[model samples]
Target: MDMDGGWCSLEEIGPLSKLRRLTLHGLEDVSASSLAETARISSKEHLEYLELHWSSSGCMELRDEIEKQQQQEVVEEVLEKLCPPPRIHELHIKGYFGRTLPNWMMVVEACACKSLSILCLAYLPCCTKLADGLCRLPSLERLVIADAPAIKSIGSEFQASSSSSTVDGGVTESTSAAFPNLKYLSLVGLCEWEDWEWEEQTVDVTAGAMAMHALERLEIMKGKLSCLPPGLANNKRHALRELNLVELSNLTSVENFPSIVELIVCDCPKLKRISGLSRLHKIGIGRCPSVEVLQGVPSLHSIELEDGTIERLPGYLPCVNPKFLKLTCSKELHGSIISGSSSEWEKISHITKVVIYDIEDSDEG
Candidate 1:
């Protein structure tokens, strides 16, 4: 309960009824029957977690688009009277200027909440989509869509819907999976998120392999993503195991991610290719210079190259040798890795720990 605009009058608190966490920010002077009694105190079934914020400085003084669609219909009528609490598990809707949302946030069994796992839809500018029943929530594990810059697309209605089963007494129809137990997925600072297709015949094929079957750690930063979500492209990820792509400059491609095992690609400069990640053990490539090549990672032990634009390396290794090789790069690639070249010390000679620094001694250490 954090309304800064006009303190008090969510029907004056009263029956918190064992409230279990709630945050309502500077609601630009709430009132629509006190936001419908704060949506009936969030339909308390012992509320689980709900955050609703408004007033991005009173929506930057609504620079007229008919007064910002009349303050986006009064912030979608106070987020449809601030409803959400059918056992809400976690829901955060920040700085809303609602373009749409209501209808119990797109029917999670009509806002039963199904114990929602975590859903954060941040700084909505004019919410283009998302929150339209958010893939029908089946215990969403973790989802973060930040700083919405007028979403570009996450189409296919974000899947998850078909339900009906009874077999043996006859009924059968079960097929729905979208964020089906999602596991840590973050998309930050969406600068007009490019696309996230998903609509391959409205799921089937066992609901498209139960959709991202329990995804395991995936992060995309500063987005404008050019690709991703063909079930995480190439070989369709099974249980993504840690993958990070930063500064997505209209990402080009990183091909397969067959159960990735720790991989980071930063400052994607029109990413070219990183080949089929064959269970990488740990690899970090920064300021990518259109990644020329890095054969099929064979459970690579460890490698962290930043800058210098990878002069050379990655011929085979990964038969369990390398334990760590962090190259900061350039003083002529640290003098071609120590001795100008001897096949770069036979290509990092079975590395058990090689940290070639310098790039101004790694920024003056």
Candidate 2:
């Protein structure tokens, strides 16, 4: 049920014990105390999903109070009282800017929701330790974090915490395990991140190797990633099947992906070449100014190229037996196609379903 910008009394939700899903969006007037009171009385023991969207206006009104340490403690205590027992499998929080995780977000006890699988946090301004707590969720399979500009690093603190123990001779066999079941991860719109640097506290190659062994898909969109994380590179032999790099302006090269079946590179203007994609079957390359070659993939069946700098097809085209080939190049290249002398045009006949349209026509019609 939709409850947006409305006063939902704690006493009103107690009768809806059979409700399976609830959304409290843009809760402008709901205070932490009232929310906690509702949680204490709500009989929705079967609730499987909950979404909370904090109001920007509400946060502004309590900004000063929330900043005080005592106020923060009060807020956490209220949240703990309000949090439903771990019966909610999917939890999504948006616009939650608290400096630390809400007390209800502790993974060890909150993950008791046997069906919990997906957790999404969006537009959270102060979630430095959220990732660490999230990794402890035993059944978590998919996680999406968007617009969290303040999250400077992930998997870094845990690595650091472990290292401190080793240096102090406190390391134990139990310390090596973390996030063993996570399979899909997506990060987007983290504008301040320059790179995924491997600091001393970052996960070691071996740990990364173990993580990659279980990971099957990764999408990094709109970040400043200059290179692949070293752990993924070192463990290239893992089971990853799909890789997507979108609008990452600083990325210039791609490391090998021998098992990947799909690779999409879009809006990476500086990307000039792609290498070591031998198992790729589908490729989409668009808006790249420097790309000139399609090399190292013998099994490609679908190919797309648009807005590139190369005047002719790269030397590797003849080797690809693509079933669906699409190419859109400069208007100048169109004249060569009409005149029938472009060497690039010669290679099109080899592709089974070749479709070439000038950039202008492709855009207008």
Candidate 3:
């Protein structure tokens, strides 16, 4: 209930009708759309959770394009009259500068929020796609699209389409498997997201083309992604474990994720390869500087490297066989790994436990 500035008495929520949860901020000063359908909010059938905000000065401080398409057609008619009923299960739209989004979020198989299991669309400085049959949500499980800088491209209809079922009596053709129980997906600050078309294929079972099959966790931050999407970095449909990449300026390579265990990379300035993850255990690379590969991990345990502009001690650490190694270098790679006869101290002497901090005695310099 954060109906900021203008427009009130919008039918006073039409007697709330047992509104379970709702938050409406500014809503770009909704002027009409029948005053937002008199707040009937899809007949509030036990509305589960919903938040629609608009007002980062409404439409990211518009730069006039016919007044930002008349404020995106008045916030797309107040989000098509704030439709959410049908047991909404958590929906969040923030600072929406709509450019086509509400038509009740597609999902048709007779959808009206098939108990939506969490959907977030943030900042949205003029949405451009995303929200097309959401792979026919079958109890969606956490999807977050942040900042949304006018999304650039994400094709293959974002997974699963071509449908038809009438078995044993005619037509037959199946490919259903898109976010089929999504576990977690976060795409942040999509600053001109560079194409994603899902290519990695190896017949993702059940009649091909699966997507996000019970995905474990995936995070893409500040995108400009130059790859990934062969149905998800292909390693032949393995329920991903965890893969977090940040500041992907032009992702170079994060090879086939064959059931990744954990990998967190930051400031990916043309990340140069982190080869095939074969059930990798742990990794945290920061300020990546053309990483030179950590080939087919053999179940590594842990490694957290933070390069404060390296000067050594990162030849991919003797092809990691982690047992725990923190190291935040660049005090000349912490004096070349404490000079234990440098070779980066025998490439972390079969690492069993090593922690070194350098960059001017770390305090996050």
Better of 2 and 3 by TM-score: 2
Report, for every candidate in turn, its global Cα lDDT versus the true structure: 0.72, 0.65, 0.79
Error of 1 at 357 (Å): 10
lDDT, model 1, position 311: 65
* Tens digit per residue, CA lDDT, model 3, 1-365: 35434445657866879978878877678777787888888888998998988785645566787887877888798888888887889999888777878877754455568888999988877788887687677788999999888889988876755365767758565646676788899999989999997664464354234667678899999979877766676655567789899998998888878788999999987888888788889989998878888888898898898878867766878876889999887777787668788776897889889988886778666
Q: What is the C-alpha RMSD of each candidate to the true structure, in Å?
A: 15.6, 4.9, 15.3
Question: In model 1, what is the error at residue 222, expressed in angstroms?
Answer: 12
Candidate 1 vs 3: which has more TM-score: 3
User: TM-score of every model?
Assistant: 0.37, 0.77, 0.38
Report the lDDT of model 2 for residue 337: 58
Number of the top lDDT candidate: 3
TM-score of 3: 0.38
- lDDT tens readout by residue for model 1, 1-365: 45435555566554677778777776656645355554476667788887877776666676667876766777778777777767889989888777776767765563467788898888787778876466567787899888888887776656544354577858566556566777888878877788887643333355345565677898888877776766555364567789898998888877677778888989988887776778889978887776667767777888887786556554443333558988777677678668845676676767778878877777877
Total clashing pairs for each candidate: 1, 0, 4
